[model samples]
Target: METVRTVCTICPSACGVLVRRQKADIVGIEGDPESPMSKGFLFPKGLSAIEYMRHKDRILYPMKRKGERGKGGWERISWEEALETVTERMGKAKALCGPQSVIMLRGAAKGLPDILLSRLGNAFGSPNITSMGFLCFVPRVYAYNATFGCFLYPDYDYPPATLVLWGVNPSETFPPLFRRILKAKEKGTKLIVVDPRRTESAQIADLWIRPRPSSDILLCLSVIHEVIRRGLYDASFVERWTLGFDRLERHVEGFQPQVTEPYTGVSPEEITAFLGFYTQGPSAIQEGNGIEQSLYTFQMQRALYVLEAITGNIGRPGGKTRWGNPKLVERYGPLFTLQDLIPREVRERRIGAERLAPFAHYALPQAIVQAILDGSGPKVAFIMGGNLLLSWPDSKRTLEALGRLEFICVSDLFLTPTVMMADIVLPAATFLEFDSIHMPPDFTYFAHVQQKVCQVGEARSDVWIVNELAKKLGLKEYFFKDEYELYDEVLKEEGITFEEFRRIGFLLGRKEYRFYEREGFRTKSGKVELWSPDLESYGLDPLPKADPSSLQSDPSYPLLLTSYKPYPFRHSNFRQLDSTRMLHPYPLVLIDGKTAASLGVKDGEWILVETRKGAARAKAKVDDVKERVVVMEHGWWLPEDGTFLDHNINVLTSADPPFARETGTPLLRGVPCRIRRL
Candidate 1:
């Protein structure tokens, strides 16, 4: 048996793992004993590595669709044939649609693939290349980018003061993290959870504010109003480190605690009490699921940051601090080797102008998907690395738009539902057969060595596939000599050497920047912009506030429908991860026990659910889990049982833009809907 030390890319948690293989086949998998995050243990999903490699669904060779799109028919092709076909078809698309038409989409959150995807896009003369950042975490990234001049998350070291949770439930989504959070809580960090559902984490909190979904901005604004009105804010800090104070002061003039209540459902007293927590210095405002997944996510995150900024609690031991390590960070310090290498004319009309801020993605993937559907700037798409069903705005809409693409090329490891829409589908290497440097999801700074543990019949890494295409299309010099050469180029200024990365499978750099302390913001004024010049430049309102509240518009869709990453899985990433799949054999919609009683819905029963966009059915999970909502786990595809029923949540999700808010991201969570018995 040959044992390899690598990290699991199944999810962003970045668990380090040890994959033991019998020759070219995986035999055993376990957590890296020396891993700082999981500490030598693995989540069940990671433990099932062998099973994942041996699963029946894994694409073992390059397959050309034998019939029409979504027909589930394919014929195996040799590497030469596959590459030639891709080169010819994609070249035609590029020649007709312009290089801008060919886009690169990432499926995995692990940073390694980005290096290749970006390179592939650049070499192929395409300017549009993106990941799921826009849909999931880019809002937080954008907010920090706009304000604090950094995207470093606070070090979450809540000690003495209150820990305010703005609707995030990391406990259930990441149980291993929950265990650590519990330990932190046990040491006297006060917990305050703000979510519509009384989740397990909220139940343990000192205070829980279950406001109506999408009312987060309103709730945060009301709290800010209270903090300012009660003379509880750190006024001196605001004056020194931030700009647009006067504008914000004027903007919030009309939004008193009472005015915000009808929208947020949070009482003035609760707002008053929550504001009271900040007086005790050295606290952190960790945003919850609600704030992070909504339309106004960026604004909500900024509002939460305001609490920290105004309190002057940053850079101190326990507050949301600031971080910056120039020699180390892969994202910001200096552009990596392949960054901006794409030709100027090719990048002239940046396709994602609606959702992104120039080269920086506000939420690139989510915005670009809309751009594709709208035919903004460019119209064709060449997707790699990302699974649209799981990461984009709405699965059904994405499928529709893909069908309309002048040409669509899907490079993936499986014939997933998303792949079913591609005009040309290419079988790519699974993570197990790929060699790339991975970053840890939890720790944020650590890097890992991801080596191939087994071979998938003739499947090659997406890196090789992309590089081959670039060469065939005649961009030889722009492409990498090999994976090793690419790493050398990318690592040119990023400091970490391949030698060092391979030794321990992880390398830790110095602690990064914390909350705004002597912080220089990135906007025109170079201060934390309460009302940014950047926003004003876009001719949009600079300061964020609650959306017009009077429109609880749709009467037919009465309940707010939303989804979250469940503990057993990380969206579709783990669908084929055997251990995690066994946890939930079929997708189910979680309904509150009280709500189910009112609707005469019982546990484990299938029911029909429809929204204005579309309709589907999911098994009802009526339990004492939480209340006032329907909780369907995000990321499962609609089932194909030959019955007249559907299973995917994307079918019902809306593809509307400005649902594409907060700088190009769409509101994927907290969707408003109503459910009935089938």
Candidate 2:
């Protein structure tokens, strides 16, 4: 038996893992004790990596649909035939309706595949490459870039005096960060958790501030007001390295804690105490997906950045700090994605680009669906590593839109619901079966080598498939001959081959605090923009503000519905694995005991959750949730039963208008809904 050091790609944590193998069979998977980031911490999902790679239902070869879309019948086909069919369909669509007639869709941003997909779209002169980013972390990315010109990552090395987990339960979503927070807590660092539900993190927090769902912006503004009123803000930093502080102070005048208490569901006294803890010393606020899925995603994130700045948390030890990528490595950006290949006119034609300036070249999923149904969207779609039927909102519409497509191709490890609708399906290798470079997403300044311990039956890496597809589409000059050549080119500046990088295992970038001191923040005025001129230039609000009236209780749909990702899965993955599925036997709708009693719902009883859009059923889990709020699990699909929509929370979600203007982020959270025992 031999053990191979690699990074787990099941989720974005990219935790270091050791895959023990006997010849070609994977024996066990565990956390790498030598990892600098995780430090021997491994979640259940990482531990089940072997089960996922060796699943019986995995698609081992390329296939062509034998009958109508959504039919299970398929015929095994050669890679050459699969490529030819895909190239023919895509090229035909391009010839008849211009290159913009083909759309590329990806799910999670798992390292190189995202870049490769974007590159393929640009090289093909299409500007409609879409991903889950609109509803995920893209809003935060936009807010950070527009406000402070960079991402603010927590400095785990320098434990914060106080850590504020705002709308984030790192305990489930990010175990590595949660472990660090626990260690910091042991060392006398105060912990404050801001979430509507009583999460594991909240239960252990030094202080738990439960605000109303979608009222986080108002809560943040009130906190800022309290901090300013109490003179707890950093006067020195504000005067030296911030812009529009006076406007921000004036803007918060009407949003006092007393005024916002009713709307935010947080008391003035609690807000004061929250401010007291945060302003105690060097602090870090970790924002999560909770705020990113709201109607006010951009404004809410902007408010958080303003809060961090006013508290003097930015660019300090044990506080939020801007980071740079590792030296001599290929950075994932416009240059790497070959953004220049697509002309300005093609980019202008991107769906929803006219309204969302920050959307840039990517298309919104809802807009893409609408365009397809209206005969204006791409006729051919090439989806990589995504299950739109389960992940995207408005499932009925998504299904209809996909049916309207002239041709669809999917690349995945298994035959997912989305794959069921594909004209062709390409087998994709799991992280353990592929050799590639893995980088942690969003502020983790590190890159590592993912070693291929074994290969499954004819499965190929996304990089290999993309390069081969590019070659078939007559774009060979822009792509490498093989995956290794691409890797070598990416590592050229580092003066190391892919083999050498594998031996090195990982490369961590130097973490520099107060980077703005050498050069001011990367904004128009070269300082943190409390009120952004760039936003004004983009025809958006220059300052962040939350409308309390938007939170008024809806009489028609009295209860609020929200969703959370369970610990055992990563957005529609791992449900097929018996080991993981046994841990979470049923999709749960977590409701407060009082609410469940009122709805005549008992524990473990299946209940119908109805929203303005539609309804879905999930098992009732009476828990410590807010009285009028119900939290359902997102990404629910039963592969064993072959029922994808019955339990999917997206069926109860809307992709309608009133989206966040900046990022086109749909309201995936805090939607008005009601429930009934099934």
Candidate 3:
């Protein structure tokens, strides 16, 4: 009984599945109905991938920290003494605080160990790697590469005649794009949804809208000021491929919909019936991580790419298209993260690259926990597969900047609450025990081949722990001569061999709609910058701007908060899988039944919440959401009662200082907070 097939690298919807195996005992996991992008639809965290790869708190080997650091003590060591104690504490923290003090920390995007942890921090010269990409999906991929230089996605094969769903729910974080938007809402499209919770894709929306929670950039500049005051743009593709349409129509004419309806609780006839069902034609929208955990994340993703380039919906056909990527696979930028072997003053010392220097390729988990609580950051971290003490924000200032780290390590599988502040843990493996090349995130333009169906004890593979910690940190002439010679040098420009990409299990790529009408929009004004001269040459705000004092409300934190991703965890991973904690057992929150009966809360009780950076608890349900909001549920922890930071909603978030100044993106949605009845 073998079965095998492959793909589910847990999250990033790399679905596909199959597994079964009896010889080395996986014994079942299904889905792969010939996956052409999750067609066999398997979620519940990919059918509890064999109960989260045989969990019982998995972590199969390599240990160490027998004392201090969150004291659950360890010891069992040996993967050559946990790679010679993480190569002698990262070679004495790169010989006394130098390889930019050694940072790394990654999470989400577990494929090719996120380009082998940026090729092990650019071959150990370090540029402070960091992740949760400024509140996920890299500030909507740096506001779709500063407006229309790409990242559009959602073509769902040309069926959309209107789909919106902004602040996305894709029915619990993308169930294969909510079963292709429920087969394009049974062929008539026009769904809408916007979200301030009531979401099972807003009870099958044909218009749901809810606004006010970080007032989605004043409800997207009042729906781009009533779609250019009702002309409903796309005026011949904004006069042949836009570029600051009269400075984004005089900067969204001071956001109108009746003066931004009491700060976006939406109405001006529901922003003119959400621009009459989104400019009535080839629409698309999608947006999510609820406007990428706002503080106007890159100006609400550059006002949803200037509302999909003035509704012509950039590159048409069910709109927002532009796919392609398999011209022989080797992607992940700056030459697969070797980044010219780190120079330019050691990549300008990356701890938040002197104020988001165009997202200095990664450092900003709240500016490396405020530069490791201000001793100027990174005194050794490494992390990988993160939990950043229940997913970073302010869990009491990320547990006091990871207890002011002076060497940490981690790599996971479970022991996580940021692996009890590790001093070396390791284990890892899973996605059915290793073999690589998955791909499948957002643009779903395919790549496949995640084979390895077995191995458990002595776990490994985060590309064999970054190729044996780049050969004990001497960086081994910049890594590779292993993990299938790093998957045959990323499929050596398609000559093949990673066993012919696991017998061509997948590769797909070529969709190509109006690629900016034959090579335009890559920016520096090759069209579609809609008021961006590259964000006024990176000093930012060349267009999308809407503060409204960051949606006011703070009569002593009078309830706002937000958070979601629940369909049985992925962020802080499968709560020690009892079949994905029996399909999400506790941590709930929700609220609005008249603000949980004006705060004397009820539905399954429990509560608490709080905020101006603290407080946690959970339980309450109350539902239908919006009035004075609430929501909760993101990646909470229980792991069979180890209870990390008591139901961590990033211990009431707040990585501080305004943020989204072009992707330092902090706020983690709406925020304020208050609740109680615990």
Best by lDDT: 2
RMSD list, candidates in order: 3.3, 1.3, 23.3
Q: Report, for all candidates in order, the number of backbone clashes.
A: 23, 0, 2
Residue-level lDDT tens digits of model 3 in 40-101: 87877777677677777888998978778877688877898888888898888888768878
Worst 10 residues of 1 by lDDT: 637-646
Off by over 4 Å in 2: 328-330
Worst 10 residues of 3 by lDDT: 325-334
Candidate 1 lDDT over 139-205, as tens digits, reads 6767776766665444454453777767778676655565656766888777788877667888898
CA lDDT scores, all candidates in order: 0.67, 0.88, 0.80
TM-score (C-alpha) between model 1 and the true structure: 0.90
| Greater-lDDT candidate between 1 and 2 | 2
Give the alpha carbon lDDT tens digit for every residue of 426-461 in model 2: 999999888998876654577789999998889999
Inter-residue clash pairs, candidate 3: 244-530, 244-531
Model 2 whole-model lDDT (C-alpha atoms): 0.88
Query: Which candidate ranks first by TM-score, i.e. highest?
Result: 2
